[model samples]
Target chain A: MDALIEKLKGQIIEQLNLAEVKPEEINPDSPLFGEGLGLDSIDALELIVLLEKHYGIKIQDPKDGKTIFQSLRTMAEYIKSQGKS
Target chain B: MDTITSYAHIKHNQVSVNGEIIFQSYPSLSLPEFLSEAYKALGVSYPKFHKMDAQCKLGFLCTEFTLNGTSFLTENDITKTAIVLSNAASSLETDRVHQHSIDDKSNYFPSPAVFVYTLPNITIGELAIKHKITGENAFFVSEQFDAGLLVNYTETLIQSGTEASVMGWVEVDGTNFEAFIFLAEKQKYTNKNAIFKPLNKTSVITIYNQTIWTH
Candidate 1:
C-alpha cells in the first residue's frame, strides 16, 4: 500500500502537470481535490484517464469517483481492491 | 476616420511599442525563452501565463504590451473592447503537439490541458477571460497578413457599437512567430493639429511592415 501510494504521487504530478510539485510534497492521506491539490474539474477528468491508462480500472459509476478519488491512499486502496494495482 | 492610438509589435527577439523598439535579446534565444524573458520584463504575475500554448502566450504578451499604456479607458469600458486577430497557422503548431500525444494508443496519455488549447480562437478566449472582456471577438486564418480585411472588419464592429477594437496579426508555427496588436477607435477628436495616425489600411500595413527585420 505504501509503495502504491508513492507511485500514485508521481503519476498524479505527471498527469496533472503539477510541474513545481514534488512526489514527497503530496500527503497520501490528505484530500486530492479542493484545498489539498487545488485540482479542478479538468484535472478530475485527467485523473479518470490516468486510472484507465495505468490500472485499467474503469470506473463503473460516476458517484464512485467521489470516494475513490478522495486521496492518494483511497485511490490506491480502490485499485488494490480491484486487483489491478 | 478612426485612429490607431497604441500598438505593439514583437518579432524575432525584439519587442516594440507604438513603432519604437523597447526590448531586444540575442538572436540565439528560443521562442519560449524569449517569451519568458519578455514576461519577466513586463513585471506582472499571472501564474496561468506559464501554462499557455505558444499562440496564447504570444497573443497574451502582445495584448499586455499594447494595452499597458492605455490608462485613459476604465475597466468597464475596456471590458467592452472587441478583438479581431489573424494568423496563418491557426493553432496548427499546437495541434501537432496535441496529436503526438494520441497518435498511438500504446503510448497514448492524452492530456486535457493540451487538448483544451487545440482551437485558435481559444487564444482570444484566454485573453477575454484574463482581461474580463465580454465583447465580441473573431480569429481569422489566412494565407498571409490581410490589413484591408482587418481594418474593414474592425471598422464595421466599431461602427456597429463596439467601444473600440484591438486588432492585429499573431502567427506562431515551429520556430517562426510574430505578433502585431494595435488599438483602434473612431476619431473622437478632430483637431487638425492632432498627430495620431488614422486607422486606415495603409497605416495598418505600415505598422505591421515596420517590424520586418532584414536578414
Candidate 2:
C-alpha cells in the first residue's frame, strides 16, 4: 500500500504537469482536490486517464470518482480492490 | 481616435515589449524552457499558465507583455475590450499530440487536459479568462500575418462598440514560434515616449516586421 501510494504521486505529477510539485509534498491522506492539491476539473480527468493508462483500472461509474479520487490513499485502495495493484 | 498604445513581439530568440527586448537566452532554450523563462520575467503568478499548450502560451505571453506597457484593460470597460489574433499553423502542435494519443486503442491514453487546447481559439479563451475580458473575440488562420485583415476587423469592432482591443499574430508549431500583439483602444494617450502609431495596415505591417522579418 505504501509503495502504491508513493508510485501514485509520481504518476499524478507527470500526468497533471505539476512540474513544481515533488513526491514528498503530496500527502496520501489529504484531499486531491480543492485546498489540498488545488487541482481543477482537468486534473481530475487526467487522473482518470492515469489510472486506466498506468494501472489498467477502469472507473465503471462517474459517481465513484468522487470517493475514489478523494486522496492518494483512496486511489491506491481502489486499485487494490480491483486487483490491479 | 483608435491608437495602438503598446505591443509585444516575440521572435529572433527574444521577447520584446513596445520594441524593447525584455527576455532572451543566447543558446536558445527549448520551447518549454523559453516560455517558462519568459513567464518568469513577466513577474506575475498565474497557475493556469503551466497547463496551457505551446500555442496558448505564446498568445498568453504576448498579451501579458502588451498589457504590462499600458493600463489599457484597467482604464477601459473590460467587458468592452476585444481580442483579435491570427496564426498560421493554428493548434496543429497540440493536435499532433492528441492524434498520437488516440492513434491506437490498444495503446490509447487521450488526455482531457491536452484535448481541451486542440482548438486554436482556446488561446483567445485563455486570454479572456485571464484578463476577465468578456467583449468580442476572433481567431484567424492565415498563411502569413494579415495586418490588413486585423486592422479592418478591429476597426469594424471598434465602430461596433468595442472600447479596446488586443490584436495580432501568435503562431506555434514544433520548435518554431512567434507572437506580435498590439493594443488598440478609443482612449487618449499622453505618454511622451510612446511610439504613437494608429491602428492602420501600414503601421501594423511595420510593427510585425520589426520582430518577425528582422531574422
Candidate 3:
C-alpha cells in the first residue's frame, strides 16, 4: 500500500509538474482538491485517468468520480476494494 | 505628435513557412526551444512559467519585449494602457493536445500542463502579470489576419482616453510564430466632430517609417 501511494504521488507530480511540491508534501489521507492541493477540475480529470491507467480500474462515469476522488484515502480505499492495485 | 516613439520585435531567427519571421532568439529550436531561449534572453530564471502553455509563452514573449526598456511609463501607467491582441488560432493546439490525451488509450491522462493552455485568454493573464497591466485586455480570434479590426480597436482605446494602447497580432503553432505590435497614444484633431477616417496603406507605411503625420 505504501509503495502504491508513493507511485501515485510520483505520477501526480510528473503529470501536473508541481515543481514546488514533493511526494512527502501530499498527506496520504488529505483531500486532493480545494485547500489541500488547490487542484481544479482539470486536475481531477487527470487524477481519474491516473487511477484507471495505473491501477487498472475503470471509472466509467465522471459523476461518480466526485465521491471516489474525495480524498487520497478514499481513492486508496476504492482501489483496495477493487483488488487491483 | 502622438506616434509610436519606440518599438521592438523578436522573431524566430529562421524564416517561417510564409516567409514571416517567427520571433525567437534561437532560430534552430522549435516552439518549446525558442520559448526557452526567449526567456533566457529576457534574463528570467523563474521555473513557474516553464510549464505554461504555448499561447501563454507567445503572449509573454511579446509583452516582455514590449515592456522591457520603456522608461516613460511606470507600474502605475500600466492601468491606463489597454492590451488588445488578435490571433488566428484560439488555443487550438492546446485543445488538440488535450483531445489526444483523452483519445489515446495508452495516455488517457491529460497532462495538467497542456490542459491549462486550452483557454484563448490565458495569454492575457500572462501579459498582465509580466507588465502589471490591469487595464482593459481582450483576445480576439479571427479566421485570417484582420488589420481593420486591429486599427479599429486601437482607435477605440485612443478615443476612450486610454493613455496608451498596446495592440498586436500574435500567432504560433508548432514551428510557426509571428508577432507585430504597435504602441499608440491619443491624437487631438481640430475638427473634433469629423468622422474618423482610416489612412491608406501607403500613408500608414510612410507615417510608420517617418514617425511623422502629413496631409
DockQ of each: 0.41, 0.73, 0.26
iRMS per model, in Å, is: 2.3, 1.1, 3.0
Could you tell me the lDDT of residue B17 within candidate 2? 78
Mark the 10 consecutive residues where model 3 chain A has the least summed lDDT. A13-22
lDDT accuracy of residue B9 in candidate 1? 91
Per residue, candidate 1 scores C-alpha lDDT tens digits across B1-215 of 77778789999888888777888877799999998889888888775676688889999999899889675246327656888999999999899999998999888877888889899998898888887777779999999989999988887888778877878888899999989888886556355633356888998888777664522
- Best lDDT among the predictions, by candidate number: 2
Worst lDDT run of 10 residues, candidate 2 chain B, spans B206-215
How far does residue B52 in candidate 3 sit from its true spot (Å)? 2.6
In candidate 1 chain B, where is summed lDDT lowest over 10 consecutive residues?
B187-196
By DockQ: ranked, best first: 2, 1, 3
Off by over 4 Å in 3: A19-41, A56-82, B1-8, B13-26, B45-48, B71-79, B102-116, B129-132, B142-148, B181-215
Q: Candidate 2: give the clashing pairs.
A: none
Q: Write one digit per residue (lDDT tens) for candidate 2, span B67-156.
A: 885778779898999999999998999999999999998898899999999999999999999989999999999999899999999989
lDDT of 3 by residue, B119-209 (tens): 8888777777766777787888998656567666766666676666666667776667766555555443233432211322332343223
For candidate 1, lDDT tens digit of each residue in A1-85?
Answer: 9999999999988777675578998998889989787777878888898999999988989899999999999999999999998
Q: Which has the higher DockQ value, candidate number 1 or candidate number 3?
A: 1
Rank by lDDT (best first): 2, 1, 3
In candidate 2, how many Å is residue B37 off? Answer: 2.0
